[model samples]
Target: MRVLLVKLSSLGDVIHTLPALTDAWHAVPDIHFDWVVEEGFAEIPGWHPAVAHAIPAALRRWRRDWRSTRAERHAFRARLRAQRYDRVIDAQGLIKSALVARQAIGPRWGLDRASAREPLAAWTYRHRVRVPREQHAVSRTRALFAAALDYSIPNTVADYGLARERLPVPSTAPGDLLFLHGTTWPSKHWPEAYWCELMALAAADGLRVLLPWGDETEHARAERIAVAGAGHGFVLPRSGLGELAALIASARIVIGVDTGLAHLAAALGTPSVTLYGATRPDRTGTFGEAQIHLSARFPCSPCLTRECGYRGASVVRPACYEALDPARVWAQTRETMSGSREMAHGA
Candidate 1:
């Protein structure tokens, strides 16, 4: 059976949808998938064995200046509509995602009105499946795919079907530990001081720390962190998603804030310690083996807002992150690494 899976932008959201393909791959016989994802995250779907094609969706880019990109938008629509599939599943329950799913040639399926984040998105789906929203995002997606594709949801832990050999290993020696500190939201960012402390802590423990940066701000932060970490810490050159994925795959342990790379580490089955301040870990934390999450003990935590309500309320910008300090994160990181090493040695 051929299926077109529509799950668009936001790096974290795209990562969250991987395990569902794993589930579908295992349960369905000869099931082929074509995934529609944001152009930036186009590399992800191809990592899965079940995905025959990773259809690039430039919705985010085209929408920036819709009037100027009419021809490109038209071409994208034409390409999407050209392929007739057995099923087009809209894994993302947003209106924009619904629109994308509607453009595909197939019997559409998605979360029903009550289960969808944007209830109106359900209108586009011919077969509306009701998956509970209370569960973690990974579990919810697994259930959604099961319902959409006529298979029972597996009881076992989620498996993101990414292979080690598929990734191109970087030529540089792998760092003993990788620190993924860059995040999209201000409230989600762990303080630079805290990150610097963790880098120094890792260095003191005879661990080489690799810090990756995407933009100028993150580069600056990494530079400061590398200096604080002394000789053992190094800042990596600006890397693409694939390069960063390779780095994540190569690291002995990954220590990160609540970022998409943290999710990538989880998906890659890398032992990781993820610190959560403003966000709740239970609902959408990193899922998979050898993953640990530390959420802040603040009243306004998990506010689910881009901006912090308690800014300037305490020493930390978000104030909630005060509880999730460097010492706390470092301790957890050490414990997780120790556990991973012991497990590796069959202890």
Candidate 2:
């Protein structure tokens, strides 16, 4: 069976869909997938063996320079419509994703109005699956696939099904820690001073630290962290998603704020500690073995706000992050690493 999956943009959401692909592939080995994802994340779907093609959709880019990118968008749509798919699943139940699914040549399937994040998007689908909203994002996607494909949802752990061997190992020694501090939201950031303290703790523990960055702002922050590391931490060169994945796969442990790279690390089966500040991890936290989520216990936490709204004394900073002390994070990191080792040794 040929299927077209529409889950575009944002690294974490795209990664969350991988397990569903794995489930579908295991149930029907002959099934092949053609995934439509944002151009920036097009490489993700190809990581799964069952995905035959990773079609790049440039809705975000096109909206910026519609006239200049008209030809490219036309070409992309042409390529997408070239093959007739047996079914098209809109796992991302947003208007933009639903519109993308409509462009394909198949009966569009998606979450029903009651279950969809955007009720308007449900109208675009020929078939709507009623998935619960309270479940984890990975589980929701798996359930959606099972309902759409007419198969029983398997009661198994979420398997990302990424080809780990495809990534080249970096020249890093064992016990090295990768710090993922770059995130989109201000509220999601762990205090810089806290990061420095964590680096010092890692240094005392004789573990080398590596910091990866995305943009100039994040790069500057990483540079500061490296400087504060006192020769124990170093800033990594700007890398693409694949290269970062390779780095994460090679790391002994990863300490990160709530970000897509953290999710990627968990998907890669890396031992990671993800600190949650502004957002709650109940539904969207990383799902994998050796993954630990440390949520902020502040009263105003999990507000899900993009910007920080703390009007208290400047000394207090963001109260949400105070509970996640660097020492506490380091302790958890050590514990997670030790647990992972024990599990590997059948302890």
Candidate 3:
């Protein structure tokens, strides 16, 4: 079966869809996948054994300069309609993904109006499936694939089918910590001061702390954290998705906020602790083995908003993040990786 999968953008969402491909491959040995994904994350689909290749979609770029990008849009549409697929599945319930799925040549399948984020997206599919919205993102995608492909939803731990060893990551030494400090929302950021303290604590215990950044602001924050730590914490060179995956896969431990890299760490099966403040873990926390999720106890936590609204006086600016202080986060990280409360302080 040659399946066309339309799941575009947001690194974590793409990672969540990997297990569904694995399910399809296991359920039907002859199944192969060709993905329509954002050009930025194009390499990931091909990493899975079941995937034949990725057809890069530049919707984000095209939307930026729509008038000038007509030729590119035409070319992309041509690529989508080039080959007839056994089934075209849009696991992402967004209108953006639905538009791409509509252009693909196949018997289209997707979430029903009740299940879809954009109800209109369901109209494009020949077969629409109803999957509960409350489940984890990984589980939801798996259910969608099973309903579309006519297979039982495997009652097993999701297997991403992409191993850490697939990347050419270097061998990292023991007691090295990779801090995934960058995130999208202001409400999701664990305080910079908290990060510095955590790095300092790790360094004092004879650990090497590694930091990576995607933007100038993140680079600056990382630099500040490194300086305040006054130990082995240092900023790595700018890296791409594959390089970041390699880094995450090879790290001894990962401590992170709600970010795509945190999800990547989970996908790689790295020992990781992901901190949650404005967001809850029930729906979309990092899903994999050896992963720990720490959510805030603040009253307005899991706010699900991009910006903080609290005007109350608190130790932490976001306020909700105060529930997940540096000392607590570091302790959790140490305990998670060391697998013992005794080793939480790096004893």
Candidate 4:
């Protein structure tokens, strides 16, 4: 069976769909997938052996210059239509994703109106499957696949089904910690002071601290953190998703704010401590072996807001993060690392 999967953009969402592909592959051994993802994240789907093609959809880029990029968009659509897929699944139930699924050559399948994030997107699907919204994002996708493909949803843990060998292993020595501090939302940031303190704690424990950045703003923040560490920390050069994944795969431990890289670390099976400030862990938190989630304890926490609304001058920069002390995070990080090491030795 040939399938076309439409889950575009956002690194975390793309990673979340991998296990669903694994489930489908397990049910139908002859099944092959052709994933339509944001051009930036096209590398992800190919990491799974079940995926035969990773089609790049420049939707984000095309929207910026729709008139000028008409030819390119036409060419991509032509290429997509040329393939004869048996089914097209839109795991991402947004209007934009539904539109992408409609361009394919098979019966479109997606979440029903009652279960979709956007009710309007459900109308585009020829076959709509209702998946429970209360479950984690991973479980919802797995359930959607099971329902759409006429297979039973397994009662086991999620298997990301990515080959570790596809990513180049970093040369960094063992016991080195990688801090993924770059995130899209301001409210999700762990305080810079807390990061510095955590670096100092890791340095005292003889662990080398490495900070990875995405943009200019994150680069500057990473430099400041490195400077604050005085000699114990180093800022990594700007890296693509694959390079960063390689680094994460090699790191002894990853301590990160709620970001896609944190999710990538968890998916890579790296021991990690993910600090949550404004978001709740029950719905979208990173989940895997040795992955620890630490959520804030403030009343206004998990507000799911993009910006900090606390107005008190006496409060921390992001007051929600104040509840997560760096010392406590460090303690958890150490415990997770120790447990991972023991497991590795036992295996």
Write candidate 1's Cα lDDT for 65-149 as tens digits.
Answer: 8999999889889888887999999998999999999999999999999999899999999999888778898998998999888
Q: For residues 233-346, could you state the per-residue lDDT of candidate 2 as single tens digits?
A: 988877787878888888889999989999999899998999998887888888888889999877788879888797765444566788889879988989888887788899
Candidate 2 regions exceeding 4 Å error are: 169-175, 314-316
Which stretches in model 4 have alpha-carbon errors above 4 Å?
Answer: 169-175
Q: Write one digit per residue (lDDT tens) for candidate 3, span 1-347.
A: 89999999799999999999999999987999999999999988867899998999988888899999999899989988999999999989888899899998999999999999899999999999999989999999999999999999999999989855556554443237899999999999989989888888988887788889999999999999998668688787887788778877767789999898888888887889999988879899999888899999988888999999988989886889888898888887777766733354666
Off by over 4 Å in 1: 311-313
Please give the TM-score that candidate 2 achieves against the real structure.
0.97
Instruction: Quote each prediction's TM-score.
Output: 0.97, 0.97, 0.95, 0.97
In model 4, what are the clashing residue pairs, if there are any?
none
Lowest-scoring 10 consecutive residues by lDDT in candidate 3?
166-175
> Candidate 1: TM-score?
0.97
lDDT of 2 at 312: 67
lDDT of 2 at 273: 94
RMSD of 3: 2.8
lDDT (Cα, 0-100) at 324 in candidate 2: 81
Candidate 4 C-alpha error for residue 283, in Å: 0.6
lDDT of each prediction vs. the true structure?
Answer: 0.88, 0.88, 0.88, 0.87
